[model samples]
Target: MVQERLARRRYGSEVGQWSGWASWSACSRSCGGGVRTQTRLCLEKVAKDNGTDSGDQPPSRAETGRRRLRPIQCVGSDKRFHMCNEEDCPPEAGDFRAEQCASFNEKPYKDRLYRWRPHYSTKRPCSLTCGPENASFYVTLRRRVIDGTRCSPDGGTDRADHVCAAGHCKHIGCDGVVGSPRVRDACGVCGGDNSTCHLVSGIFTEPHLREGYQLVLQIPAGACSIRIEEVVPTRNYLALRAGNKEFIVNGAWNIDNSGQYQGAGATFMYRRQTDTQGETLAATGPITEPVDIFLLYRQMNRGIKYEYVIKRNASLSSVLPRLPNDLQSLPPAPPPALPALPQLPARPSVVPRPTGHRNAVPAPGVARPPHTAPRLPATPAGAGQRRGGVLA
Candidate 1:
């Protein structure tokens, strides 16, 4: 009983303790989600160096009662921040870039009155392109985008959309005409009757064209469609679009992949047959007008020899124009001119109230003379009677 009592008493006086965290702080923001915090000041308990009992001494003091401030071991970083400010904005108020561009000036840029272009990002090409009247080395170009106009990318003048790219044109044959110097299709070719044409098939390689890539082949009026095959190399691809329908021809296999596909014209299907080169595809029964052919290739002036031919008496006519897509999808107009500054309902002019001040000060040069009393009749020395202020 003595041993049990001593053991129970030894452990009775002390226990470890810690405090719970305080309540969380209010949310940082109202509309959008934000951050809050809850934290606790960690208090540490340690045995005193003086070997004093904590039960007898206060938590801060040891046996001597001197305050011992122990460096904190549990100093914690608990503060945090997060996203906020999600109030709904007006529909048209969000696009700051457009507003910046649309900002106006009464006078801007070289003293021009109404600048059609934007104050920034105005470097875009404007003009049509054409080929030389004759095959001279000369090339003419319209002026570049205005100087100091920001390039589209804003870094520098590279691959800029609004600025003029070096315009290119396909080589019009010696006989074929581009835009100017209109002459008859000399060989009476594409639009010509079959009298001048035969089953001519060979590598017809022409080096140049005018302005952009367009090749007009004269198919007879009755023939609806035709097929072109690649002879030498493989994987020469071309796309043909009529009305809204489009088809691709992998000329390597000489497949008229387009002739079988749905077109705006009548459907025609043909199979491939070896014709010493690769394969042959024939387009039948869709021709209503002369077929316009365009070859799709890059590094245009690199002068790669392309081996292909139009078989059915195709003649070199004029090259049609390849127009570029609009550079910027501009707003229909300039946001209605910012609503005309609201015409501010003019008010009648107001009469200003006079400042409170006395008017007693006489104007300069005016003066008041002293008033003299009416002459009083002399009165007898002792009588002292007065009527109208005369001395009695």
Candidate 2:
């Protein structure tokens, strides 16, 4: 149901483009230069559509068209004002210049010198008030026109309404405030001239569905480039539907990147099992549905490219560890601590006493004790050293 609604909205956008062509063509001629032939063709089409004759008047079609599109004017005996087709206004009387005021002729018919006298300058004031003097003039003019009274040469029309007949009107009121018109056109809203409005053929949208994956595409303003990549697992089948084509990921694939693959510097990923699905068994056993992957890229003038990939479900764990050499570096683990050893007690050392020998010789020229054992003489210890030294 969601997909159906998206498709319908896309079609509606296309229809709007066709309906706006007339306005777009007219606007292009008004703004673009050096496209004389194209502009002429566009203008002719607009004229035919609007019920105006193309070949009737001036040297330039644009000028002729402008003249034919006369501004609606309101004229009264006391004042003369211009009204666009959309709004009502009183006529203006204009002001007499200084020269005209100075040259007022008292003698009506016999003044031969009238030829040298300056004529009054009848200058129509701005429709909207700019200041106090202007406000006074506009108010007095509007009142006189409403009352059906004649104004002096120096006085203007009682009221002059400057209505912007353009689709999106910006009416500047007498109080110096600019207000939006009730009617609006697409041109004003989009700020587009003819070419821009016409170039936008249409817009399309599709509901992206991935049972357990959430995807978001980020687009920068004025960036005409975009790219998408999809990764699929090996054991479980994955399928993606984009536009009219369906893609199938045959084995464990790094469609674009993500998951454990992201740890390996991959940007996108897809998991083998649906986390939300958990261990709950479906009526049809383990769902072997193919995982769908979509890739989309767009570039200015180059246009847009969309790609899809599908793969069987094999958990990301199986695929991530098997990534190529470039992604093989895993984070280092901490060293293990040394095991503790059992403590042992210290042992005591024993010393042996020296024995008497050498035929009971006296010790160093001294007589031995009566019952004590005689000590061996030191008789050149070097000689005895030749024999076995210690207990020998």
Leading candidate by lDDT: 1
Model 2 poorest 10 in a row by lDDT: 278-287
lDDT string, candidate 1, 60-142, tens digits: 43622432233323323333222223343356553322232333224343453331222222322222211222333221123
Q: Please, what is the whole-model Cα lDDT of each candidate in the order they appear?
A: 0.30, 0.22
Candidate 2 Cα misplacement greater than 4 A, ranges? 1-42, 46-392
Tens digits of per-residue lDDT for model 2, 1-392: 45434533653211110112111112111110101111111112233312235465434788657645643221112111222222112234222222222232332323322212222112422211111211222111111111111122222223222222221123433332223233222222222232311111111111222222211221111111112221111112222322122332211222322122211111122333232211110011011221223222111111111222112112222111111121222123332332222232222222232453212222243342222111222334333221211222
Let me know the TM-score candidate 2 reaches against the reference structure: 0.12
What does candidate 1 score on TM? 0.20
- The number of clashing residue pairs in each candidate reads 19, 36
lDDT of 1 at 267: 40
Give, for candidate 1, the lowest lDDT window spanning 10 residues. 318-327
